[model samples]
Target: MGFADTIPARLGNLSFRISLDMSNNSFHGYLPKEMSHLRQLKLDLSRNLLIGQILSALSNCSRLESLDLSYNQFSGYIPKQGIGNLTMLKKLYHIYLTWNNFSGAILASISNCSKLAAISLGHNKFSGQIPNSIISLCHNKFSGQISNSIGNLRCLAVIDLSANNLTSEFSSSELGLFTSPNRLHIFKNCGLKGNIPDSIGNLSNLVILGLGDNSWTGSIPTTIAEINLSSSFLRGPLAPEMGELKDLESLDLSNNQFSGKILSSIWRLESLDHLSLANNSLQESISDNL
Candidate 1:
């Protein structure tokens, strides 16, 4: 009786009215089947050692909203049908599954949770080009290209898909017979491969771009220097004229096949904090002023 093995019986009525905090306990084994009985529970069992499939019985808790089972050892695809039915909890918002082994394409069941302000599935094993609607976070293990439809995320601001296998197109051929302008759009650390798209310059309001760590071959977009296109697969020496973007922060064109002069344009990055032009073929008059 001294062990916290099950949901405390005295709190059943209040389960629907308050958030459950059973996190950071020694609880193990499959969640007891009776968890489905709490009709109003918004449970949080993160940071434990819970495992097994997210049970389908969760659908029975019709009045339930906001479930967090993150930071556990749970694996397998999120149950699709059961979670899709929780249509009434318009206030349900946060889902944090970081630091777990949960796998598969995200449950399209998430669309039912449309009011969700954030979904954190970082440090896990999700694959394929992420579906853009859900606004995924990729780092160090996933791969694939950022779908251009991602430009449609009008409210998106903070996307960190760094340190993985992300690749994308830079420029088609030249700026002459092209579609739009040359704006390099690279969401890194996914298996996205190929050259950078020249059309990216059309995204005139872009900030915090990352196209590093992939197989993209082309010249850096000149317009990109005027903007803030940093940490990407930029080839050739950075134009001496690049020190133009007044709002640049992190420029990491490292670990690729870029060659040419180390532009003092780097010094123009008045707001630059992290600059890594390492492991590229750069040769020119070095400026100590930068």
Candidate 2:
């Protein structure tokens, strides 16, 4: 661990810099605005004790491609003129600002970064409707319905908005917009309700799905694999067609209101290694064929 103190202002005077990594240090105090003078391609100051608002002057780093300032005590809204100005940098592809005290609405200007592939902004105090451009935003205080505009990001392959205060019913149209073949969708504990859209069957490329700890009301989507819908309002017979998901390895429908005889076809799932149907109105015993 490095000694805690303000970063030296003189270090920013260096020219032709390509990268600077000062992460996992004890550095505290506000980030120096002068550091933006270095035209670096990547800058990482994460895992530090840095505090105070982010300086808008940092936007001067026109060549910066990646910026990571996570795991710090940095608070206040991400300045629209500050970090938002980085949209002009066409090469910027990644931004990591998770585990901070940053609050307020995520700037819509972020959508201008067309080349961006990944961004992590979880574990913060940010609140408000998510920007249509963002793909990953979890563990925040955001409320309101998830905008249908999110479906416009055709290339988005991951969506994690878990642990928020949102109280909106999951929309089928919003769910069907995700056409990405290899996607991981997680919306656990976001206060979501309503039936699980049958349109979910369209996500043929979905690899992992987590929608647990909400108030969902519907039968299990028979086509899904590696699903977790535990602790919800879901009721009805466990779909026998679930046997069609030959690739399913984990299925958890516990703590629900389902009532019916265990389907005999479930024995056909050759790849399933984990199964939980506890706390339901299920009847009958496991077949002796096992």
Top candidate, metric lDDT = 2
Off by over 4 Å in 2: 2-5, 287-290
Worst 10 residues of 1 by lDDT: 174-183
Per model, state how many residue pairs clash.
23, 1
For model 1, the superposed segments whose C-alpha errors exceed 4 Å read 1-12, 37-42, 61-65, 84-91, 126-132, 137-186, 198-207, 218-233
RMSD of each: 5.9, 2.1
lDDT of each candidate versus the true structure:
0.58, 0.81
Model 1 TM-score on a 0 to 1 scale: 0.70
Judging by TM-score against the true structure, name the best candidate.
Answer: 2
Candidate 2 lDDT, tens digit per residue, 25-140? 89989887788787766888899999999888777777778899999999999887777755766678888898999999998888777777667899998988887776568999
- Estimate the TM-score for candidate 2: 0.91
In candidate 1 the C-alpha lDDT for residue 64 amounts to: 64
